[model samples]
Target chain A: MTLNRVMTVDDDRFDQLAYRRILKKTNAKIDLLPFQYATEALEYLKSPTRRPVDVILLDINMPRMDGFEFLEAAKTELENQIVIMVTTSMDPQDRSRAETFAPVRGYFSKPLTTDDISVIDRLVAQQ
Target chain B: MIDHDSNSRAHAPRSFAQSYATALATYVRDGNEENLSRAYDCARQALQSSISIGQLGELHFQAAQMLCSGSPSPSPETKRTEEFYLEAISVYDMALRGYGESVAQLTAEVLERKRAEQELRDVTYELARQRDSLDQKVKARTRELQAGLERSERLNSQLQQANQEQAQFTYAISHDLKSPINTIAMLLDIISVDHQEHLDSECLELIDAAQATASRMSRMITGILQYARLVGQEAEFETVSLDKLCRDVRDDLRQEITDGKAEIDISPLPDVRGMPSQLRSLLQNLLSNAIKFRDPGRPCRIAVSAAPKPRNCAAEITVSDTGIGIPEAYRTRIFSLFQRLHTYDEYSGSGIGLTLCQRIAGYHAGDIQVVSNEQGGSSFIVRLWINERERDNDTQSGDDG
Candidate 1:
């Protein structure tokens, strides 16, 4: 399929549940998937089955491989995709570092809801 | 009782007239002696003038003959003069010694008084120095307090802004989540009513779980909305029927209390002036907290009471619970937004309940605080001010704009 896709990667089961429930409400013309494991999700996206994810929702805290590590590894392979780091932390230094990735589209907080859709949609349009 | 002999030896009285006569006469009598020769020379001319030269010579010879005879008359006239001269000489010697002693004593007294004056002057100077130093310290301390007050004011304004943001977060949650819950609820109701026979048991069970989750989400959203509303609107001050109001609140929360294995005891409630709904929610939040943070050892018992405020001035309402009380360190933090002493799995609600209660109490010109140990249950006290209620409402509402 040529249609663009959006996906989320987080270690938390509750975060995945909340992300799915929220992302399903989007009226955007793109496919979306959520994953709890970074490597498995990365492998699947790298395989021919999933193509051209338009937006990525990456969470910071995970078991072994965190969002920063995932970004480092997948930067070359999926350099084409727009990455967004969503977390509960309001730390300014982290935000600045995330901004170093030129393709980063947005950063948001926890309890993700329909409120976040407009910002993401705007970002997707501009890109 | 001084000894007279000792006193006499120490000093003697002065005789001025006797001392003058003795000095003149001794000069006349001792003209030949070296000690009084100067006086004798000065008197010789006067003596020669008083007697003719031949008579002076004859009187001298006769006086010398009478003085050697020891016959009690140098001539009787010379005898009287010689005896008076002897008495005068003794008086002169006594007067000289007395005058010397008086001069020495007066000099000593003057020096002693001067020394005492100098010591008093030094003590006065020291006291002045101490007073000046104390005055300067007091002024410096006052300035420091004023500066500290300004800094605290800045922090207070920042805290007020944070509180407003927390309230706004609630509004956002409500506005964002309500429609989804309603849609899910409606969809489930439609399916259950229309397609009862067509649906299998497992499918029915899945749909039931979905509906229940949706319901729970709806309740949580409503709770968040109520919390936001309590903080957003200005408080309304009126006569609050404490007894009836609490009863209604208890009735509303009875099911939740029972579900959590709790008992609520309402002591006699005093009629107070406050916003009835917000105050009811405040009491409800406290009681609900008692249920939410229950201990393994204890079935929760919430005790509510009211008594005359100290100094017979205000009214106080107390709510004590036999649940897992707040830790001593969390007493201040529990009033903060999203401050959860316990984890999410242990308690099933948003962490802003007590924060809402605090905001409501603040709006009513009242304050609420908690006192508890590590494992012991907590006692919460609410102090109210009826006269300041309108002013407090104005202040709470003023922050929004």
Candidate 2:
């Protein structure tokens, strides 16, 4: 299982930037693609892309299409892509709701550190 | 002639017969069953004392004729009406029996009267029994309604207690989450320093912006927790001097006053009974607003005055300032939580200061309002009743805070 492309769906630009910095610092060789809107990201996944994304970093709180809605739509549309939920919400109910999706591999709070990237790296390697 | 003379001798004393006639007349006139029953008792006594059946029957026959004529309706619904009908039947039956064989036609009349009396007695008995049962049912229904009302009241109080507990839980959660936000801000600062060589100016700015947002969020959360804590707080009430309170608040805002070039004048104020800390906050909020919303053209001039309102009804403490007056439309809404009239750039506030002031005033059984001053700026008046006993309506319970 050789993985290459990586994708991130988050509304916050800073958070997306943080992920870019963390991913570059932890594993620079991995390919990264970022989307500000969940709907656009889902559309991209549904399209006949040349390379399928191996991992997706999804934020739960967003404008129109939230993280949960994206996961539900992406489940039937996309092939095997590991989802790692990224959110600033401290709500316990949100964690339980996120876990309901089969494709979700992990969950982490905002300001994701380099240590968190290592854990994600290991999870991606398992795929 | 001798037998006739002896009859006249017996009729010479007519006292019992006269008394019985009078009672029968009263019963017929009033239509009261009790009176009719009394008439019957009188007749029975006269008979027991050797009054002739012929004489007793004649008196009863007259009473029966008067009662039958006085009968208002046929279907006796009331217990008294039933009694009257039964008594009338009994009197007529006895009168017919008195006629004996001397009046042969009365034998048919006696049989007819006896049959009618039996029918009426059965109907009256049934009606009386039904009335008694209905009375019992009404009493049972009343008891059921009273019990239901009490149960709902008890449930309502329980619901109120549950709501208060839920509020406290939410406040505690917000209070606890503040530390994590601070930690995140601190971590971002550290990351900026550690990656300075690798990071560009744009990246450093983004990190700083993120840290600022985190700090702002923490402040907002703290404001919410403060508001929630006020709902169920129990503070000891004391007689506080407003002049001293204003002085203390001025001291707290000394730096702001100096920066804004503001002058605060305090008048002789009335002593009020309330929670000292809450009253101080109320004064501090109003005073801070007076300083914050000052006109840039001139130095801020604020006067704190208190006067006993006419008729000794309530004491009014006014905090008048030389600041831009608030529009009348926004005056009422300003007391609401998170309602800000100006942007964060123009006014630096969590928008919870005035809200807290309103809550504190409510706790002390007072009201705070802003009105335009004729001399320019705004006057925020706080009306407080002198008598603490009248403050019962605004008193806070531990569960409610």
Candidate 3:
């Protein structure tokens, strides 16, 4: 199936809900695939049957494989795809680390509301 | 010495014989005649002279006895022999008189020599002892100086490293901080300015969300800047009046507290010493924080007071708020940069306000103390001007220990 949406990979259910709620008002035709578990998210992203995403909202703090791990797996293959990190963490080192991914767009902290997803408009426009 | 002693004769130089006799007499008197035999030539000569005098006396007496016997036919040869004996006795008596005089003089000289030797030995021993003590003291002083130099070097390097790290931290914060904020802000500006009225309800929601995020970001950047300034990254300090400082700060926060829900009580604060702009900022942040974090149902009451230590030498100012007080676990955590106890939805804080306040106190050679309970509110005590004498008094506070 052709997918023209952003995937939010987070291990916490509340965070997924929050990110999904924030993404609802965006004018972009985007679908949000929230993975509460890391392994499942990685499996879905690696599957050949799934179409590539326009952007990925990866949370920094997670169980199993974190956003960093997901970024590593999708390294060169997801070069064209935009990755906007979404998490409650404000650590400087995490932001610096995310810089390694050329496609990594913006970092957003939690309690994300409709306004925070405008980065979607920005990122899609850049692509 | 010549004018005081009145005895110029005592200093006459001794002949070899006189010197020998004086040394022997001195050694004997002191009971240390270990080399007396080698040094007694003059004393032996004096004894020989005395023996010669006794021989002369015996000869004279014998001649007189012969004359008294009146031997009529005295031979010319016997007369000649008697004359010779008399001459020999006269010469021997003269030699003995000279020896006696010489020995007496030598003995007197020996006593003087003994005193001189005793004084020389005492002075030498004393000098050696003083030299040894002086050497030890110099060594100890040099070692102490070296230790002091090393400590200074270590302190200097540590200070340099700390400064470098501070600069880097500020730079990193400044350099990377703006890009994200500007990007977010630019995005918001573009959407709100370009596509606001034309936007549907859903699109309008995006604009609102972006504005909130941008506003929150701007507040955080301001908070971090305040934190840096408070952490001694800012330069120079000017004297600030306490009463005026508090009033100015209160005035500055007028817009913040004008929500009119807060009851702020500020007594006259005593000024000691500090930077006004920074202090005002500190007061403004603290006052505003009190108003911002109050209980929703109850009206917020804030009290600001200062405690001075003896004639305005040092002061401790406290800011207390009757708000939903911090939990016991969160007290220590509140001073860390960007550490927030409450979520943004409940309370709006950049989380760097108290952290900056503490850093400011430290920069002014002061400290901040926090006290609070779960039910009650938090009171922050800031102390300044901690000098040596005050520390001594603190140590002597009658605690039995």
Best by DockQ: 3
- lDDT (10s digit) by residue, model 3, range B1-401: 22333443343222322343344334433433343333333334433444334433453345344443554446543454344334444454566688788898898889789888988988998998899999999999999999999999999999978976895687578657868888888888888789878889877776776677677877787776656555545557766787888887887777778784776788878866788777777788788888887877777788898874433237788889877777666677788766665545556677778887877777677767678834388787878766555555765443322
lDDT top scorer: 2
Candidate 3 regions with alpha-carbon error over 4 angstroms = A1-127, B1-148, B151-158, B161-165, B168-176, B232-237, B308-313, B373-375, B387-401
| Model 1 alpha-carbon miss at residue B199, Å | 8.4
Rate residue B356 of model 2 by lDDT: 92
Model 1 DockQ (Cα-based)? 0.04
Q: lDDT by residue for model 2 over A54-101, one digit each (tens)?
A: 788998876446788898887876456689999998999999998888
Tens digit per residue, CA lDDT, model 1, A8-101: 8876556776776667666444466777767767787678776676788998765335677688777776666778788987888878887877
Per-candidate interface DockQ score: 0.04, 0.04, 0.04
Candidate 2 Cα errors over 4 Å, as ranges = A1-127, B1-145, B188-208, B310-314, B386-401
Interface RMSD of each: 8.6, 9.6, 8.6
Docking class of 1: incorrect
- Expressed as tens digits, the lDDT of each residue in A1-127 for candidate 3 is 2225767777655566576666665544557777765557778867888877767778776544567877887676576787788777778899889887787878877777665666566667766
* DockQ, structure candidate 3: 0.04
Clashes of each: 0, 4, 3
- Give TM-scores of chain A for all candidates: 0.84, 0.92, 0.85
